[model samples]
Target: MPASIHAAASGSPTRADGRASFQKARRRASVQALLLALPLIVFLLSTFIAPIALLLARSVENKEVPASMPALSRALDAWDGRGVPDEYIFALLATGLRDAQQSGQLGTVARRLNFAQPEFRSLLMRTARSVRDETPPAWKPALIELDERWNAPETWRLLKRAAASPTPDYLLAAVDAQVTPQGNVAFVADNASIYRQAFLRTIAISASVTLLCLVLGYPVAWLLANLPATSSNRLMLFVIVPFWTSLLVRTTAWYVLLQPGGVINGVLMGLGLASHPLPLIFNRTGVLIGMTHVLLPYMILAIFSVMKGVSPVYVRAAQSLGAHPFTAFVRIYIPQTLPGVGAGCFLVFVLALGYYITPALLGGAGDEMISQLIALQTNTQLNWGLAGALSAYLVIFTAIFYFLFNRIVGIDRLRFG
Candidate 1:
C-alpha cells in the first residue's frame, strides 16, 4: 500500500480511542457534577418536601388513639353503631386508660379524641384518674358512674372513630360538616357552622383585595412608568418604604388608622365627610383596607415592571391611525398591560389568602379568614389534625386558583412588572 494510505489506516484507530476516552471523561464529569448537587437535593427533600408531606399526611392520619391505646382501639373497631359498644369494649378502655395513666399517654389519647367529641378530654381525664388504681371492670354501670359520657352512644362512636385510620372527619370539619350517628356526613348545627362561613369570607376578602390592588396599583404603576426618572424614583420609595417596617408593625399601624376613632375617621370627620365616626374597624371594611394597603406594593411593582417595558409609541401609533385618544389607549395600551394585571391579581389574591396577623388584628370573628382558624386550631385547640386540614384546604385553594388563572391569562404571559 502507498505510504499515505498506511498512515491514514493507523490514524483511524488512534482517533477512535481518543474519541472513546473523551466520551468516558465527559460521563465522569457529569457524574461528579450530580454528586456535588446531591447534598443540596437531599437537604431540600428533608427540610422542605418532607415536612409538607408530613403535614398533609397528618390531616388524614388518625392513628393517635390506636398507637396510644391499641387494646381498647382494636376492641372498639368491630363495634356496630346500633347500640353503645359492649361492656367488654368499655372494660378494654378501662384497662387501657389505667395503663395509659401509668405510662403517661392518657392526655395524648384524650386530646386526640376531643377533636371528634366535645367533652372527650374531660371524659378521658376523669376516667384516667378514677381508673388509675382500679382493676379491669366488667361492671358497665360502675364505669358509667365514673363518667356519664360512657352512657352515650355518641361517645362510643367517637371512641370507635378514634380507633380508625386516615379518616375524613377533619377534612369534613374544615367545611363545617361532621359524621352523623349512622356514619353519614351532615352539616354541623347552624349555630356551630363557622368554617363554611369563614371560607366564604376568606374568598370574598381575598378577591376584593385583589381587585382593589389591581385598580389602585394600575394608576400608580402607569404614572410611575410615564413619569420622569427622578419623580418615579421618589414615588417608588413610597412603595418600598413599608418593607422597612415589620409586617406586624404595618398591620398594627393600619389597625390604629382604621379604628373608629383613629386617624382616618378623624380626618374624615374633620373634613365633614361624615357626621360621625364610621364603623371601619373590626369588620370587613377594615380587613379590606389593611390588606389592600399592605399588598398594594406587590401589585404596583408587578404591573410597573411590565408597564415599563411597554412603549408609549404603540398608543401614539394607534392615535396616528385615526383612533380616538380613549380608544387608542384602551385598544392598544390596555391590551398590552393584561399580562401585568393578571400577574398582580394572582400575586395579591394568593398572598392575601394566607395573611394571618393582618386579618386577626383588623377583622372581627365574623370577618376572620381561614388562616386565623388554622392558627386557632393549631395553637389554642391544640388540634394539629384540624390545623393541617385547614392548611391543606388553603394550599388546594391557592393551587386551583393559580391553575385556573393561568389557564385564562397564560402563565407564560406573567411578567416581572
Candidate 2:
C-alpha cells in the first residue's frame, strides 16, 4: 500500500476531529450555562414559584382535618348529616379533637374547619371534654342530652363536611357558592354572590385607573420626550419623587388631603369655592385618586422610557412636509408610543387589581376591592381555604392578563428602560 493511503486508513482523520472538537465545546458551554443558572433557578423556585405553587395547592388544601383524623373521617364518610351522627362518628370526633388539642394545633385546625360551619367549636369542646372521661358507649345518650345542639342537622353536617378529604366547601363559600341541600354540586346564592360583584368592581376599577393613567401620562411623556434634556430630567425627578416615600404613607397622605375636613376641603371652604365640604375621601373617588397618584409614576416611566428611544426625525420630517403638528404627532409619533401605552396600562391595571391597604384605608365599603375581601376572609373570618382559593383565582386572572397582553401586544416591543 502507498504511504498516504496507509495514513488515511490508519485514521489520521480531519473532518472527524473538527466535529468531535465542536461537540466537546458545545457540551462544555451548555454545562457552564446550566451551572451558572442553577442558583437563580433554585432561588426563583423557592421564593417565587414554590410559594405560588403552594398557594395554588392551598386552594385545594382540605386534607388537614381528614388527614389529622383519618379514622374519624372514614367513620363519618358514609354518615349523612340528616340526623345525629352515629356513635362511631361521635367517638371519631372525640379522638381527633383530643389528638389535635394534645398537639396544640386544635386552634389552627378549628380556624380552618370552622369555615364549614360556625358552631364547630362548641361541638369540639364538648366532645373533647366528654371523651377524655372514659365514658362508656351507652353514655352517648347522656352526652347528646347534655347539649341538644349537638344533635342538630347542621352540626352533624359540619362534622360530616369536615370528615371528608379535600372539601371544596370553603372555596365555594369564598365566592358565596355552596353545596346543594343534597350535598351534590355547588350553587351560588343570589344575595351571597358578593365575590362576583367584587370581581367585576376590581376589573372596572383597574381598567378605569389604567385609562386615567394613560390619558394623564401620555401628554406628560410626550412633553418629556420633546423637552430640553435638563428640564426633562428635573420633571422626571418630580414624577419619581413619590417612590421615595412609603406606599402606606402616600395612601394615608391622600386620605388626609382628600378628607372632608382635610386640606382640600379646608382650602375650598376658605376660598368660598364651595359652601359645604364635598365627600371626596372614603369613596370610589378617593380610591381612583389615590391609586392614580401612586400608579401614574409607573405609567409615566413606562411611556417616557419608550418615548426617549423614539426618533424625533419622523415627526420633524412630517411637519416639514406641511403636516399639522397634531397630524404629525398622531400619524408619526403615536403609533411608536403604543407599545409603552399598552405596557404601562397593563402594569397599572395588574397593580390596581391587587391593591389592598390603599383602598381599604381610603375608600368606603362600596369601593372596596377583592383584595380587601380576601384579607377579611383570611384574617377576620379565619377562612384559609377561601383565602387560598381567592388568591388562586387572582393568580389565574393575572396569568390570563399576561397571556392576553403577550398575544395582543408584543412584550418585546414594550420598553423597560
Output the number of the TM-score-best candidate. Answer: 1
Runs of candidate 1 exceeding 4 Å displacement: 1-47, 80-82, 144-152, 189-191, 411-417
lDDT of 2 by residue, 1-417 (tens): 976677689978566677999999999999999999999999999999988787667777677677677787787787755777767666667678788878776776666556666766666666667777766656457567767776677666666776675767756765778776566766566666788788888999999999999999999998998899999999989898999999999999998899888999999999999999999988999999989999999999999998998998988999999999999988778878878887898899899999998898888988878899888976887666778888888888898998887665674455322
In model 2, which range of ten residues has the least summed lDDT? 408-417
Among the numbered candidates, top lDDT falls to 1
Q: Report the lDDT tens digits of candidate 1 across residue range 1-417.
A: 976677687775455668999999999999999999999999999999999888888889997888888987777777676667777787788888888888888888888887777677887888777776665436477788877768888778877887888789889988888888887889967677788888888899999999999889999999999999999999999999987889899889888888788999999999999889999988888888889999999999999998998998888898898999999888788878888888888999999999998889998878878989888887899888888898898899999999888876774454312
lDDT of each: 0.85, 0.81
Clashing pairs in 2: none
**Segments of candidate 2 deviating more than 4 angstroms:** 1-16, 78-86, 98-106, 139-144, 147-154, 186-190, 316-324, 411-417
User: What TM-score, computed on C-alpha atoms, does each candidate reach?
Assistant: 0.87, 0.85
Candidate 2: Cα lDDT at 153: 71
